[model samples]
Target: MIREVQEKDYEIYMELTKEFYESDAVLHPIPESHRKAAWEEVMRSKDYVQAYILEEKEEPVGYGLVSKTFSQEAGGMVIWVEELYIRSAYRGLGLGKQFFSFVEREFSSMVSRLRLEVEPENQRAKELYEKIGYEILDYVQMVKERNAER
Candidate 1:
């Protein structure tokens, strides 16, 4: 089952998020303070940022975090899926598909598109996403980081 993350899921969230960042999925490791602040933000349940914890028979299995924004090019709102992580042991069990389904069901009414970025080397994820109707967006994505810690 998929449920919005709460304060009680802090440990699970931290564990999975750490694993994700440490894995080959992300570009670099994030600072602990940044992670902690992100958790606090998720707990606040803001309109733009949302987090969800996936469970199996009441046991936490994985987590997903997404951010919302308006996009004129998209003609409406876009939900950018920032992170989706499943325990190594729990993969291949359809949890990834479940998460996608949950996203559409929970936010399709308010979103024009569901977007996410994937590492080019992560063929498995790219294939899964493509199979689920996510097309490759050819635009070059660039980021300008501020001096403040992320």
Candidate 2:
């Protein structure tokens, strides 16, 4: 099951996020401060930066973080799945697919698109995403870090 994140989830959320950043899913380690800030932001605004803890048999196994934004190109709201990490042990059990289904059930009526990014080298994730009908956006992605001096 997937549920909205609550204040009580701070510790586990940080733990899983630490593992996620350390794993190949991300390009670099995110400082704990950033993770803390993210949690605080989520807690502060229910309308943005949504976070959910993924559960199976009533136990937390993973988490997903998403945010939404208006997209003229998409014709409406685009739900950007910023992070969806299932613990390595829980991976092959179909939870990822379950999470996608949850997204569809919960937001299909309101959202124009569901989007995410995957590292090109992460073949397993890419395959699963493709099987789920997520097409790779053929565009050059770029970002400018706000804290370049760090």
Candidate 3:
């Protein structure tokens, strides 16, 4: 079952996120300090970022966090999937797809497009997104690391 995440689920969510980042070959593992801050932001920014928990027999087994963004080009709001994780034990059961479908229904009225970023090496996730109709954007994402000491 999928439901809105509550305050009580934070601890479990943190643990699951940590495990997912650490074990998953694609994701970059974020330090616990950074994860804590990000988690706090998700809890506080209910209007912008909303989290949902996937439960099995009343226990949280997975989670998804999505944020709303305005797109002038699309003339409406778009939903950006910031995070999605399912425990290793619970994977391969179509839970991820179900969670995504739930999100699509939940934001059908406000969302013009659903977007998510995946690491280039994460072919499984890419295949899943493609199966769900997400296409790779034509532009490449570029980044530069800033050196504070300089």
Name the top TM-score candidate: 1
**TM per candidate:** 0.95, 0.94, 0.87
- Which 10-residue window in model 1 sums to the lowest lDDT? 141-150
Q: How well is each residue in 17-116 modelled by candidate 2, as lDDT tens digits?
A: 9899999988778788888888999999967788999998988899999888889999999898899999998999998888888887888998999999
Which parts of model 3 have CA positions greater than 4 angstroms off? 25-27, 144-150
Which candidate, 2 or 3, would have the higher TM-score against the true structure? 2
Candidate 3 has its poorest 10 consecutive residues by lDDT at 141-150
Q: Which stretches of candidate 1 lie over 4 Å from their true place?
A: 148-150
lDDT for each of the candidates?
0.89, 0.89, 0.83
In model 1, the Cα lDDT at residue 29 comes to 88
Q: Which of the predicted structures, 1 or 2, would earn the higher TM-score when compared with the native?
A: 1
> Could you give candidate 3's per-residue lDDT for residues 1-150 as a string of tens digits?
999877888888788778767875444566787667667877787778887888888878988889888999878898999888888788888988998899899999888889988888888889999999999998787878552221
Task: Give the per-residue lDDT digits (tens) of candidate 1, residues 1-150.
Answer: 999988888888899898988998888888878788788887776777888999988999889999999999999999998899998889999999999988999887888989999999999899999999999989999988874664
What is the full ranking by TM-score, best candidate first? Answer: 1, 2, 3
